[model samples]
Target: MDQEASYGFAPTEFEERVARAQRLMGQHRLDGLLLTSMDNIRYFIGVDSTFWESYTRPWFVLIPATGAPLAIIPEIGRAIIEKTWVKEIRSWPSPRPEDEGTSLVVEAISGLPRRHGRVGAELG
Candidate 1:
């Protein structure tokens, strides 16, 4: 799809949401948040893609305690994500079941500055 047209929330709105989440994370002593679901990802980064309905691959966005989120996604979705405000993105070729960006995810998580060494993820 053409990402030429901007989509989703204003950049400031997304920034405010991240700030609120970070404040909450500080109260809970969390170092970061790793989100995988489409809803949560959209809520934070404004990526709304019907392609996500396929479920053939995974998508991730890592929101550290005090900065912009990093989108870890499949290469196919890069164009869509680029239209959003997020500036840092990492992608890998999709459908490689043997790897499927697991290593990249690990690397992204490991690179965070963690005082609590605790990362929150969507569960249940």
Candidate 2:
């Protein structure tokens, strides 16, 4: 590994984890997976940036029922999150419980036309 690549994750690792998750989704009849935890998102998207600063901030990932993962990050963290090959991205600002980035997620799901799909969330 080169010095610049020392802290970064690889794309192959990302793809493998996503394939595994998709398989799990199929097995569980889950529409998709929501990742609010750091490691889980990294495993799926290969973004290994610092995330401890996000507790007061809203941070999560929405893996759509039909496409790649989309990250819901703070406005300031968008640039770093975008470095991942996972192109889908949405941002939310702090000091607002409204979570505007949520709408982007909603639109994606609404466009799915999956009227009766089960949303298996791991938020508990």
Candidate 3:
């Protein structure tokens, strides 16, 4: 079975969702979106995993204004994230209190077109 088939959503569906989100972002004059919640990540990238139950590592996904979504996650979830629609996957060793995925998140955000840009985050 193919990855998408197993995930229960076609790649096109994921692309459509990204397009819709980008359209909304543009309309709102938002530069990008930073998603930290597991549900939000799954909705954008089709990454379904129970590993999120472990709080040792944090996962994030960044959707730029005009390009593909980026996944900044732990090395443990690399394989699963790879199977998702997202192509840019940045990973690091988890449970590292010193850094964790903070550097990667910064790097991803810095790549956005605008400096000191308005990024929407899921707060709830």
Instruction: Work out candidate 3's RMSD over C-alphas.
Output: 1.6
List TM-score per model, in order: 0.92, 0.76, 0.92
Which residue pairs in candidate 3 collide? none
Model 2 Cα lDDT, one tens digit per residue, 1-124: 6523542556676666777886777787777777877777666666677753557675677775556877777787788777776777777665466764567667755555353486556665
- What's each prediction's clash count? 0, 0, 0
| TM-score, prediction 2 | 0.76
- Mind giving the per-residue lDDT tens digits that candidate 1 earns over 82-121? 8888899899988888876789889998999979989999
* TM-score, model 3 to reference: 0.92
Candidate 1 vs candidate 2: which has greater TM-score? 1
Model 3 lDDT tens row, 17-103: 999999999988888999988888888887789877677788899998889999998899999987888888999888789987989
Candidate models: Cα lDDT each? 0.87, 0.68, 0.86
Per-candidate RMSD, Å? 2.5, 3.0, 1.6
Q: How accurate is candidate 2 locally (lDDT)?
A: 0.68
* TM value for model 1: 0.92
Candidate 3 weakest lDDT stretch, 10 residues: 2-11
